[model samples]
Target: MKIKLNQLDILLEVAAQGSIGKAAKALHLTQPAISKTIQEMEAEIGMPILQRSSRGVTLNEYGQVLLRHARDIDRSLHQARDEIDNLLGKAMRQLRVGFTSAASYGPFTNTLIQFQARYPGVKLIVMEGRPQQIHDALENQRLDIAVITTANHTSQNSMYYESLYALSNTVIAGNQHPVTHTTSLKNLMDYPWLDWDEPGEHSILGQVFRRYNLPLPQNIIHCSSPWIMARMMEQTHAVSMWTSVRLRFPGYSPNLRPLVLREVLPASSIGILCPNIARLSTAGNTFMEMLRINTRDWLQDSDALEMVVRV
Candidate 1:
């Protein structure tokens, strides 16, 4: 009438791998040992958990219910182990951060450098993905903080957001692009345009074309990575909408030039999102403080530049 943690883990692994043999290889155990463990677990529960076929094994209804609870238990155990490790000074302080591609420019990089300088011993884990992916990681406790586009979410009670800045995206092309020489938005449409799109979110390219009352670009390239998009622009005549060019950052500037378009797309609000500030670890708080400082500096610098331009 007892089931072990390892047994539950094996079940989850089997489901993931879709076969007992594959799970055995992944868990570094023999196939017979894995079968024995499953048999013992099913015996204790007085029911069959998996339906076996020639190709693989699949979870039955009972197995599905047990697997859900097993995952929750596994997460709880991991949290407990982390807490104990920190209490005993056996583990280094760590902060897990996630950011959307747009948020990874300028101030975000500065904040990371500052945070590392401030806390040399703390470990920093960074992940870049779409807003939904970042939100999922934050909700699952996989990420301590996420910097993302301020999109509406249904899970308002589970997490909160703090605005970092509003980012204005512009159509950018390589310095050598023919479109770069022309001030006409009409001429730009002849070349391939890069688009960043997610399933439910609004398309950046669509907004620009709709604003100008121009038909969508004929040659459209769907890209996710900013670096890749930049490279494509550099090597080809491809163009993409980006915010980093405004900061004059070396990573994004010089290689890419903004085209003069008649339409202005609405700025997206970039923000720091977390489950709770009070629940943040020491390392997380330090990083958050660095981020706030960087944001302030960026705002001040931007204001100074605007004044100089006005003069």
Candidate 2:
């Protein structure tokens, strides 16, 4: 009933380090002291939290349940500290954001400029990753927000999802590539295909091939980094699919051109994903406000895709 914050910290450290001895060393306490803290925590909860093993200690079912709450508490405490720092005019306020490569195209960059202008005191940390990796970071409290593509407007319990722009997926190739002149998806199969490292038939190109009952491209090079993909597209005659929004960015490679295709590919929307339970800091809320304002026109133009199916 009277469990302390230090007790939860010990539990987390032990679980992270996987043994009492390691946790004790990491926390600058003796093994007995770490064991005593864990024992006190278990006594308060009236159950064994960790399972002992010959190799190492692991979290039992009870410990696993408590670990989730412990992490939540730790996140809440950090948020509280950040809020206080912002309120007291401290310069240590920081916001961590994760984004996919496509999400960094136009609107995201514009919002970052505006956010930095408004909140110069706050430090901004940005990371680019796959959609699933970004989502996992958001769930683990490692990131304050995420910008990524959402296939549909489905609801999630742990995170808030908002679709800002429904972008058309366009087939792109080097300007001198022979496939750029072809309008049919079947014709594209002749050349090497450049695509993301997504598994199975989940990619937009895969879906397009499946829609037309065409066999997937045999000569495929899968790369996860968009920058590297762009480089590969420019140097080689490989065809790839990318969002139209990415093409609008001023920094995009000039060697790449969107192919005018006869087949309509599915549309994916870019959006913001943030934790539902953790209230954003003042700086975080301000950045979101700036993002929402900057993307107002994009939301209205979401229906402006020329050769894409609205999904």
Candidate 3:
């Protein structure tokens, strides 16, 4: 059988948990699938790895043998990989990261600029895509890391990732919108509110409106891109809600000033998104750490990120 290491990891978890249900829950797999794998392994080895009964399941004697050896195999393999990575040296390793279009041009670039200065050998491959695309690439193992907008309810429900850093608490309006002083969402609710996120209404704006017990305003302007939104704001009284990080972009001009929301809009977090799996290689790990540390410091000092733009 072409059993892979990931499958083996499942095997180990199932054995330790002593229950297929718990193992599946822990690994985010279906119960039957986990059971089938264990059974298939037993059949391939010509030994009962699990003793099943009404009470639950227990690993059999031969299963113990396999477990011990499997653990050693995993340890040795990991050590070998670490040694090889070390031998390759810093410059040889690669870092493939994906980011939202804005982040690809924004913080993602800043993080890399700093990473490059320290680890010049590391090659960076960057992609700009939608949030869904970013999630897909990471889940498919096509990307080592990504900067995604967690506003997608589907993504939040899937728990496909964990956070690295974020920018919370923001208010946004187009750069040239006539109404400039927007402290509370209530101020702009009656105006031409841009309906950028249409169908789901599950965006950060949705949560904010819902929390205040205010129905979403029907008057809408549906357009994507903060740049486009900014332009729309420039011509009309229309305004679009967005997080502060969107303004942090070098492209965001003094003209597009996002007034802080007074009713306390939900904080929007922008950060590095790692897949549910283990972290990347040593170089990737180092880069991720740099992101967390740097992002925290970046938000603290937006001036530093601006400096990256100048460089």
Candidate 4:
């Protein structure tokens, strides 16, 4: 059963506007022409697509099925035009990437710089959010790539993820804090602590205390952004649980120091997540390659880990 693209477009417009006359006006077609086209569609499909009333029309179950395919066709046609324009060098390639707050401390910024240098014509958009927000954006196709913690969410069939590296939660304190000189966990808890107010029982802070069979710190300061926490630690005696990679970054040093705890906190996997590789755009794939290569180089660098310890 062959159907015209315009017919599908008309059907979608009608569904959107909830009125045949309104859809006709929107599409610059006459009301009778819109009505006849929909009739022809229903006849060809051998089912009534919409339930009509005096006020307007709404999609029936059959209409909903057709609307789904129509939307897919619209998306594909737009992508086809974009891909063709990119190939002809007439349009800039664009990639939308999403990440959690932890990404600010990771190698993402450095890799993005290399990607920009290599693909100067490509446009990059980066978004920072909580893990749940990033997951929602990925599922909605608003993001082409995501870097998130493994503890965030489990990958489903549509979401593909690969572990880039493991990250250990480190306790950070001001350089002048008394706990900075101590390796004892008991002494570390004597000061006020700051961390995200994450409700999960498996959060790094909760897990660290559970592993030691100790109660959680009562003087915990709940804050979300790691940058704020780092800045606060620089000025105050407040300690926070953060990724050790923060030390490797440029700004966290000279003031912030990771406490040398006797027990190691469990390491969490930091993964590169995207829609199945096949769904990635050219720019997305290129960025992914650069990210993987940079991350590998950073991990293999002996000096990087040493810098973490010195911090």
Candidate 5:
């Protein structure tokens, strides 16, 4: 029998669980294989590593010493990989950026475009999802950065948000809808209304519903798609509630006007969010800068209210 570092790792897991059966299950190995490996390890080390009982196994002094060193080695190995990856530019070779569907309509899109233009050598992968979904992906190491709103999760990792632009919540209705001509909410109450009835756990737009409880007309369009919802806004006299960003999309709000609803609809801020990983690749940091600059222009540009910024 020969002592080996790999066998030592298996020994550590077995010691922590106090049973070969449990360690086998955790490591996807057979209990006999673990037992044989540990037996061989004991033979090489010339020391008893465990004491068995009907209930389970317990590590003796030799096992404790081995386990401590195993853990330290495991941690050092991972830290070394992360450090070497940074030194060799693993971060810049590829990237996956995530954004909410709403952001795809503007800022996020622009940032990716600029990032592509500037770092053509780097591969870019983009994913469109809800804020919470994106946040979860980032936390799990599935995404590099996710542009999300406050209702979404925040991370303890190095995270930063540049609130580059804000969208004004406004009243919306189809072009021919009778209420489109009405100047105030009082006059608009006469028609069937379409509302952005949020489903599931998404409550980002609940504020708009609170101020205006007009019975949502029977013919309402509750959706998760900004593109489909915008088109629906133009068809039926269904009065839709949306942030000012929707108006600027090609098919939305071009001819629509903000409803003078009874109460003011609060605006939502959109930003570029970055996780402070020990290192952000040169391309990633540069993309972030481009996003900020692009959004600043869109936020200040009213002539073309809805602006799409592609990253």
Candidate 6:
């Protein structure tokens, strides 16, 4: 069935607002107009798309499917506009990228500097979050690219993954902390733990504790932001698991040092994630190229090089 662009717009707005009246107000149309547009759309599809209630409206199964495709169409239209703007030498070129806290250590910052130098006219938007958050943003089209760490070298059907390097986690603490001198994992049980991952049986810290048959630390504080995690690590005696490369960065706190434990922690793969369906924008492609160039040397030495899966 054929659907007009305006009809798709009205449906999207109604779904977002959850009421015909609210959508009408937002779209600068009357409530009757919105209802009639939705009716026409339902007629075209031969089914009711929305379930109306006193509280508001909700999308039925067909409506939910339509909403998904409508969002994809909207994103495609935006991307097309951006590409045409770039080709016409417009100054509105923009690239949105997301990376996990661990991926921000060295190469990421360097690549950003180089990317900005090469594409000074392009507007850059960067976000830092956990891997799952970054993945969600990429899926929702909020971000064009993402840098994340995966322990199992997992693959997502809607995205392409390229391994940049392998990261090994280590126990770290303040310089003056008593645990810094400890060589055994068992000795660290008494100290509070600061972690970016959720505290549970599936977490990295939990897995580490299980590996040694040691009980997970009960006193755990979860902080997701890298900057805030660094500050907390500097001020508190709480121990944390951090990547070794981040500790080498000059901007990181000098007060925190890696603990020399007898047991070796597992390593994770850090990689680039891009949407599988859409082609990258000019700026996005340039930035991706710069990232590959910057990480070439590191990738050569990484054991996770074979973990790269471009599907």
Q: Residue 165: error of model 4 in Å?
A: 1.7
Ranking by lDDT: 6, 2, 4, 1, 3, 5
Model 2 regions more than 4 Å off:
1-92, 153-158, 180-182, 250-253, 297-311
Query: lDDT tens digits, residues 1-311, model 5?
Result: 45676686678778778889998765556799899988887888899888899999988898888778878877786688567757866557677788765566665687787778877888888887766577678777777776655433323343555555555567776666664343755465555555434433455444444447644234444565767765665666656666665666675557566666656555655666665422455556667767767766766655436532222
lDDT of 4 by residue, 75-138 (tens): 8976995677578543447778898766645477888888888877777788988666787898
* lDDT score for candidate 3 against the true structure: 0.66
Clashing pairs in model 3, backbone N/Cα/C closer than 3 A:
91-121, 166-270, 169-267, 175-256, 183-262
Q: Estimate each model's TM-score.
A: 0.59, 0.63, 0.64, 0.62, 0.58, 0.62
Per-candidate total of colliding backbone pairs: 0, 0, 5, 0, 13, 0
**Cα lDDT of all candidates, in order?**
0.74, 0.76, 0.66, 0.75, 0.64, 0.77
lDDT tens per residue, model 6, 1-311 = 89997788888889999999998766656798898988898999999999988999999999999999999998888788676856855433678889876787657878988877877777889998887778889889898888887765654643667777777778888777866454887877788888777965336787788888998787988877666767777887788887766676565667778889889787767888887523566667677888888787545645334432222
Query: Cα RMSD to native, each candidate?
Result: 13.6, 11.8, 6.8, 13.1, 12.3, 12.0
Error of 2 at 56 (Å): 54
RMSD of 2: 11.8
Clashing residue pairs, candidate 1?
none
Whole-model lDDT, candidate 2?
0.76
lDDT tens digits, residue span 79-185, model 2: 88676766754423688888887777666888988787877777899998877778778888888888887555432543667667677788888778866454888
Off by over 4 Å in 5: 1-89, 105-107, 149-159, 181-201, 211-220, 253-257, 275-281, 297-311
Better of 5 and 6 by lDDT: 6
Tell me the deviation in Å of residue 260 in model 5: 2.6
Q: Compose the digit string of candidate 1's lDDT tens values, residues 1-311.
A: 58898798889889999999998766656799999999998999999999988988999998998899998987897688669759944344777899987677667888988887877777889999877778888888888887886433222443657777776666788888876443656777788888776423456567667667888878887777777887888899888777643435457676888887766555666788888654566667667888888877877786434411110
Full candidate order by TM-score, most accurate first: 3, 2, 6, 4, 1, 5
| Local error of candidate 6 at residue 231 (angstroms) | 4.1
Model 6 worst lDDT window (10 residues): 302-311
CA-RMSD of model 1: 13.6
